[model samples]
Target: MPPFSQSTPISNGFSPNHHHQSTNIITIDVGGQLFQTTKQTLTLAGSNTLFSNLFNSSHHNSIPFLDRDPELFSILLSLLRTGNLPSRSKSFDLQDIIFEAKFYGVSHLLVQSQSNPSQFEPLNLEKSMLLPLSGRNPPSKITTTPNGSLFVSHGSKITSFDWSLQRKSTALTSFTGVDSLLALSSNVVAAGATDFSGLQILDLDLGVVRETLNWDNVTKSSSTVQGIGSSHEFLFSSFESGRRNSNSIVVYDLESFKIVTEVARNEIFGADLGSAIPSTKLNWVPSLSLLMASGSHSGASGVSGNVKFLDLRSGNVVWEIEETTDCFADITVSDTLSAVFKIGVNSGEVSYIDLKNFGSYKSWNYLGDARKANNVKKEGLGCKIECHGNQVFVGKQGELGLWSEVLMGGSKIGKDRIFRKNVLGRAKDLGGNRITNMGFGGNKMFVTRKDQQCVEVWQSSARRF
Candidate 1:
């Protein structure tokens, strides 16, 4: 059956093609797409949403929802009436559908769109699962040392391990919370605490604290230590405030553990930085010595999150990508390739930004059609995304999805493998759990789960590379 053919039941946004009395019907224009329905149907979501707000002042016909996509709205309307998506556009990706559904408050439609990926391209399967970190301590963040040992942080406690997953030593075994962890050198690790402990540098050999550094003229909060990034010499961490007046990101000399400089909250382009503004994540590009930070977006453009790239050499922000919808988080980089992921913290819709072209934001694209994946929701489950080299990893609780080399520049999708929530076996068979942090080094990947008592490490099969 043709979805848009003359014989279809929906004619001009009406099911029966019957003209309704003027006072009994309402027409809406979404991105120039036409929709007609009675006022009674729009009241299902109660009075706090877009449609309910416009109900009273809406003209009898031809109400306009400017800047909205009509195809999605049409689908949303069909879902409202029929309680399911229309049979039309079988090839329609779910991202746009989820976005439209969310925008229109079609709760049921959004739920249907977020199922696991049932179909996937072929893959060279691994008969044996790579499960390391069996008896390791509970971890909130994981990173590797220069020589290939793993440093797992569980706030006040830290654990060290060799490539073989043998536990070495535990440090700061008394602290209550550690928020983020970074490897500084072969025997040194940097930790940011959840309490006002600021940042601490530890000696891996001694399993002892070496240096503790705090920001200058900055107040500490429970979330003050959100994330941290490092280069060969400088340690970058977050501070608060919006304007360039107070520092949002601060640079410190790693060797001396002294304040190097403060980065104003992206006020470099003048002060129109948007809501919920805070430097929550940071990724420092090694070869270029450039830093990419993710925070609140610019309200002027109605964008939600800001991914700004800063040039450490020139001490200036070169470019930035302002976006909304996707959760701006866990930014990661590999060689010339950097991946920025947006997840529906409350929805399961996840997508990644494949930024290449030598640290330029202008040369970037979403690896998969994020708009379609809008249906893939984690809801309040909270997700963390990790990208190393060409591979992309998305972790939500115990569930994990691995997309290896799925980025093919110019909005093209590359051929890749697809694995479901069952890859990480936990409570039963193979399923997901809470994954808090992921780190990569020496062709090995380490995953940490907040819900599980021990961390997990996976090594690439010799043949997969």
Candidate 2:
């Protein structure tokens, strides 16, 4: 039947035609083009129901005018009435339906498929079954070492998984209350805890503690040591100073097992640089020799924030950009030497920093704002940023956003921004509201939600060169 001649019945009222209803439904025109119902409903109770029943009852395979198979027709009807389907129903093949729904532009079905790819069995046969229980929890962080082995951080311990074999090997013995982990190289991984001992280097291959370096003796409560990056011989760790004007960055010489140097923000930038402001977070880019970026809390008690880059070789500030007061939550660097920072204002904003083209003192630009597009203005307190090649991924308040660079002149010019383009797992609403941290390994993105006990993983759509 033509789309203009078809109608579907509902409990509330009668729709003149599926194509002319207020609710959205899947429709196929005479030419085989698909469309979503944006407007009316058709009630079949009076006369249309009898005809539908007669036609459905008489035809098993020879329904000459019906456009879709019986099973597919039922699924489409259910989706049109209810925004989503049950995650684990065995009545019909969900994978096929998901594809059909996506092809037909069913918004709700697309969201459901993304959140639970495993719901459609045959289509997602090769995909992993592990997924977050809800949309509020974050995924786990993953790192691949030089030896081609994979390490995934869940809660306080690092679990080793083999990529070739696709199985878990062994869980590394961990430090007390460690919350974050980073693979410095094939043999070395850095672990950070909420306590103030700074960062610890764990040998994943040997499953032993290689070295532990303390940041300072202060031991502030809930103080997290983050952004543990490394070079051939040195490991750098940054911390959010719990007290005013006290946050510092510690560099450890992996060979010496001693703190090579600890620089305060004032000394690294200037005594008056962020005097009114305190350091919130810091990150180091391995490709840029002795180059580090630090985000500071807006002066004293205000809402403004600033991020400054320092040249450790010269012990001087290279570039500093003051931003509208927002909580600078996390920052990360890509394999290509690009950097990204997550700024939590009334809403969240991401800034992409191109180290290759930055002058001595140039301000970075905001890549995009996720919250503004969603029309939601919630504070992004617990958020993390990580990059893989030209793509940057961020987790804010349980939602994931993906950004890709638009390069020009053989340099990264700007980013093509897509907000809430993907979601990993659900988050549990704890008052702490912390979107703990994130990392990447072998085409997978991991995110940790502190309030939620589990870590979630999302498969990357990126194709490796």
Candidate 3:
């Protein structure tokens, strides 16, 4: 709230005859201050909200009164009208606005206004803040919610931060170290560890284990979770037996938590490298209705990997790509670009395959330094690659690189599509600890570095305030 020269109330230009001029006009008294807006504007707050309830009961004879901060109400009213916060809102604290919005039952409106996915700009992102964690263990895995809330697992504990990044809580888990963490809801998370048995569904708020999901393998040993992912209707978990002889991707109903079916069940025989590998990454491609399961294994021969596109309905591999030379260090699928991207373990260069025309391209299309394809130094050994919106983010060592598709009108896509790269962050933020994990939520990118014991938040500068 800004200081005023006089104690005048903030109001729209509505006079005594304003209601007569427009029947849609409605007046609201907030903390003794008068505010006027249209019924249609209040309806944007959604049904059952305070504003919506007021719209239903509003009468021209009696003005609706709300016992709340006038300044905050004015800001929210501006948000309701403009689908964004006004420049003047920069003067107020974001937490105050969030609390006030919740009171008015318009918290979702505020989230949409502030963290809408359309506002994510790869070029505009910069290191905004650092969220510190307890203990010496760095973040092993991290997950995020659509509303921008995040859950990070370090050692045996998981810390959660709300969408605003203002309030946070910590939860202790049963795992020795959480290797995989997925946010099922704002207050619930599915946590798994490679060395621990079963995927634990935890309640972050109460710090309790809600349930444990496991794969009943024939070996009769405990099933260890390798990766966890979710689509709209189902949750997928890659589980390997304690004996490391068998692995499978188990699918469960997202709502009921019941076993739906299993896919990619592989039994390892003596020295069978292909059947021995287990999926360490699971990504759902909603556009094509396929689940991308990728994993790599290092043997005496060299680093070898496989990327399989699995059809959940039929439990069959729709497409499979064998990675023999210069295998992927990290891989991700971008639904927006309709492509599968990977960072080579040997070359350390970004390569992508067009999913739309899968048969047109026989090999990976290198995005940077194709000459380094034969490099034997394993330049991309510990890198992490992820996609959010249309931009692809690659974390190599301590540096962040952004890959964006350059749109060309009336141009072919598979062979002629152009992609450009840009280095993210400033000179000071370029190098420090090696990046270990990266995830996206809302409009922000969450990055955790090796031995950092903190999560770095990268967001657009335009939305900083």
lDDT per residue for candidate 3 within 64-113, as digits (tens), equals: 88788888888888888889999999999999999999998999888888
lDDT of 3 at 244: 99
TM-score of 2: 0.53
**Residue 182 lDDT, candidate 1, scale 0-100:** 86
Candidate 1 — which residues are off by over 4 angstroms?
1-137, 218-223, 241-247, 265-276, 296-303, 336-341, 344-347, 354-381, 406-429, 461-465
Reference-based lDDT, each prediction? 0.57, 0.50, 0.88
Off by over 4 Å in 3: 1-23, 359-361
lDDT of 1 by residue, 1-465 (tens): 212211123435554436544455666656655566667766754576666755654663446565776666666666666555677734477556655655666654444332112211113222223333334356677788533467876646777765434335666644576667788875687777545545677887887778876655433333246578877788888754322334467788878878887774433335544524666678887755678787653344333666678876566877777655554434455553344555544355445544444344442244444454344242524567766555556775567666654333444322232213224333332345666777665545567666566656554333221
Candidate 3 residue-wise lDDT at 51: 92
TM-score-based ranking:
3, 1, 2
- Count of residue pairs whose backbone atoms collide, per candidate: 21, 27, 0
Model 2 residue-pair collision total: 27
